[model samples]
Target: MFFSLIFSLCCVTAWALPQYQPQYYSFSPTVGRGHGESFASVGEGRITGVRIWEQSNSYIKGFQLKYENVWTPIYGSTSNEETELLLFEGEAIVQISGKYNPPNYIYCLRFVTSRGRSLIAGQPTGNSFNFYPVDGQSELQIVSGRSDGTGIASIGAHWALIYRNDSKALT
Candidate 1:
């Protein structure tokens, strides 16, 4: 009886374990001196995490994530890249600084899913970044200019999505 109970407990625990599937997408946008935007759409599923990279030397004046009818501002110093592990549903829109007829700027993004699956649409690389959980949606929308709407730069983005998994809700 003791052995049987232990086996049952183990099975139950294994089944309850959270499974994570990671998906990745990359985008290259040529934002010039003015304003620009980039984004990606995900199928049905929950977004567990996100990562963004700015390949250009220019500073990102500001950035925001839009989905459904809500817009969430991304807080952080103007850096080359950023990451977050916030949970979001449906599609996602990434809006960033842009320039009019500017140089070529490259940006990348990654999305982690609750399920242990991922679909990559661009080149994958080895790099370390940080991600945190925040509130937002999972849809693509037009890029609204910065608060000042006067920055000379371009933006690119990549996204990842998972189609299946067994993970608990992200608190």
Candidate 2:
């Protein structure tokens, strides 16, 4: 009887516990687009996992990666049906709902879709975004600096990745 109780407790604890997710992170508008670069700047230390939401033809699609926070492409081969349930598993560094670029810091991520369309997420018509609708676009990119192209390091056009964060450690 005690052994069974212990087993049940362990199962409950595992299901109830929360996973490790970054407290601060940004999403790249470029994710989910056909093929383009979008940079989302995140603090060197605060970023742990980045979930770049993919968009195509005005529809939110599948996820690029489960847990990753680097200015790189979180490539994932998925279908278009995933758009209705756009999400990042567990917790992540940032949620790229669309068009919401972080100031002074960007988190660049690569994204592309089988369908070619100009992807733009977020409430372009309204302020204070509460959600990102299903949409598709050609490409998207999250910047690491100001909203406008001004001050901030760059590799040229956009996107700068040093390596893949497999361990999910912050810099």
Reference-based lDDT, residue 110, model 2: 28
Per-residue alpha-carbon lDDT of candidate 1 for residues 1-171, written as tens digits (9 for 90 to 100): 999999999999999998773324333332333334333333234323333333244333334443334445442223454433344543233322222333322222343333322221112232223232222222222232222332314433333332333342221
lDDT of 2 by residue, 22-119 (tens): 32222333322223232443333222333333333222222332213443333332333232222232212222323323222122322222222122
Q: How far in Å is the alpha carbon of 56 misplaced in model 2?
A: 34
Cα deviation at 20, candidate 2, in Å, is 2.8
RMSD of each: 13.7, 17.1
lDDT (0 to 1) per candidate = 0.34, 0.29
Indicate which candidate wins on lDDT. Answer: 1
List residue ranges in candidate 1 displaced over 4 A. Answer: 25-153, 161-171
